[model samples]
Target: MSNVLNTFLDENLQDLRTQGLYNEIDPVEGANGPIIQVAGKQLINLSSNNYLGLATNDELKKIAQNTIETYGVGAGAVRTINGTLDLHVKLEQTLAKFKGTEAAISYQSGFNCNMAAISAVMDKNDAILSDALNHASIIDGCRLSKAKIIPFAHADMDDLRAKAKQATESGLYNKVMVITDGVFSMDGDIAKLPEIVEIAKEFDLITYVDDAHGSGVTGKGAGTVKHFGLQNEIDFQIGTLSKAIGVVGGYVAGKKNLIDWLKVRSRPFLFSTALPPGDVAAITRAVEIIMESTELHDKLWDNGDYLKKGLIELGFNIGDSETPITPCIIGDEKLTQQFSKRLIEEGVYAKSIVFPTVPKGTGRVRNMPTAAHTKEMLDDALAIYAKVGRELGVIQ
Candidate 1:
């Protein structure tokens, strides 16, 4: 090993410690949607991203088990090889029908979808216009594309339009693509897809919308593209099976030709192993549930509204969030972590998000109240929040 490696590692660790950004992981032993086991105690969970409360769903579990029995435990090769199983085919077709797209392609995870999709299409001679606050996977994907990434203000379509005009009119590259998250994870705000679609059409920009946070939460379960009623206009609509769908995988829904291109070109798809039979089957079942009933979706929105109202009434600054992802905004990083620790100690399981994830000063405990959370559960969690908030002087 290089002798200088120790110096570099130590310096980085020191910097993180100086900035109060060192992380300590917490282990959750069991889950029952709104509540989970942590540190040998049951706590009301408000930090899980399981929006539909489908992660431990019995129906999904049965479907997954059935698939495993039929197809065995794994797909042993990459999709480009013989690894693409009958279940994978079924999942893709189900996704296409669910999203109302011409076709769909599956990936191991949502992060890989971004990495695969961006690089599969754009390259060094191209330019990409991205939302300033896009997810880390998108950032990495854009860099991998070798495209010159120009960040427009987050959800500011006017700024995006300006950049699109310049990029297209200037004719400076082989292609120009505009990418954004359907729902911003941190602030929990939605993207202006209508405006983005309009700009894309006018400027002939390739449009990509990552719906990881929007897939099951919006569009009555279709996604943000449909929520804005722009399904036909958006070029690439990416979604996660993990968050709202309550499984593990990602997908790209778009025109047949576009998907066909990705199947052959995306490195992750061609290089990585296919998703396990169980995960794909469970996700397929989730799609069926969402398409057939709106009960879970309704309950989720209800819980979100209930939680948001309670938090606001307590006089804590909860940031502007249109979706179920709520953040109790506490400004200092150290204090935010302390608040989260206190919340856990008080029998609530919410996690703190500090600097780098959100802006430097806007540290917060991001609460994710799922549809599985009952009214009584929310009440208990709220009582704990009130007690903790006062004890820590976070609120008056």
Candidate 2:
């Protein structure tokens, strides 16, 4: 590599190290679930998005093994050609029913779905009205669309409405669309979909909801769109087979026409290899488990409430999180990174979100409480939080 490139990389890495923001990769030696082993230390994991704890479920694993035995490991090529396995078809069908949509299309990953779906339908003449706090995937997708992106405030329907009105009234764009994360992952806040839908209707804007964190965690596993009862109204319902679904890949659920169009135009779908058979089977089984009962969903909520209440009682600043994603709001970025490192050392693994992820001073340590956590596990984690909070002067 050239000295210029090496120098740039070294400087960036140095900057991160000097600020304690350089993240050292910790490999999970064993399966990742409610708890995981890192460097032989078993830590209570509070940073995974496996809200329903389906990732380690015995049923999901068995289904995956069985499917691998029957169908082998890979999908071989892009699905539009010859890579579409029977398992892939099954997974898509199951997802449509699970999401309460007419049809669906699966991609290599949730991020791929965003990249594919956004660019597939919209073009440069179109404008994307995005939530300022939408996920990175959505932002990347908007960029890929080659469309002018206008950002609205996080979950502020009034702002979204104003932006929608302004864009529609501008008469500059051939089309206008509104895209948001159904569940804002950072703040643990739910989007005001009902209001956004109403605004979209008023302006005739295309609606897209990436329910990556919402699926298998909300509406008893249906998702945020279904949570708000606006299934059919949302033009694109994007979701992931990772996270709560206990598998890999992503999907776009909506009317048949949208999916049909995506099949032809989405570059990721047309150019990328499809989801493997085992993953597809695993996700299909996950959907069955969610549809079978709400036991995991209830357990997830119970654990979330317990952890949130415990953290609050300790007087640590947990931001206004409405879901299982609990954030200990540490304003200073350096201190936030230190707090996360200290938590890991204390056998509680969590991540620090710093500038460029959230805001400059609004740094936080976000926790994801899964259905697999017990009260004792949660209590032990909370005790560690209290100890760390007091030691760091984060709480009295």
lDDT scores in order: 0.91, 0.90
- The alpha-carbon deviation from the true structure for residue 9 of candidate 1, after best TM-score superposition, in angstroms, is 2.6
Candidate 1, residue 181: lDDT: 97
Residue-by-residue lDDT tens digits, candidate 2, 231-338: 989999999888988778899999999899999999999999888888888888888889889999999999999999999999988787888889999999889988
**Local lDDT at 140 for model 2:** 97
Model 2 earns a TM-score of: 0.98
What lDDT does candidate 1 reach at residue 296?
A: 92
Mind giving the per-residue lDDT tens digits that candidate 1 earns over 142-172? 9999999999998887899899999888867
**Clashes per candidate (backbone, < 3 Å):** 0, 0
Query: Global lDDT for candidate 1?
Result: 0.91
Worst 10-residue lDDT window for candidate 2 reads: 16-25
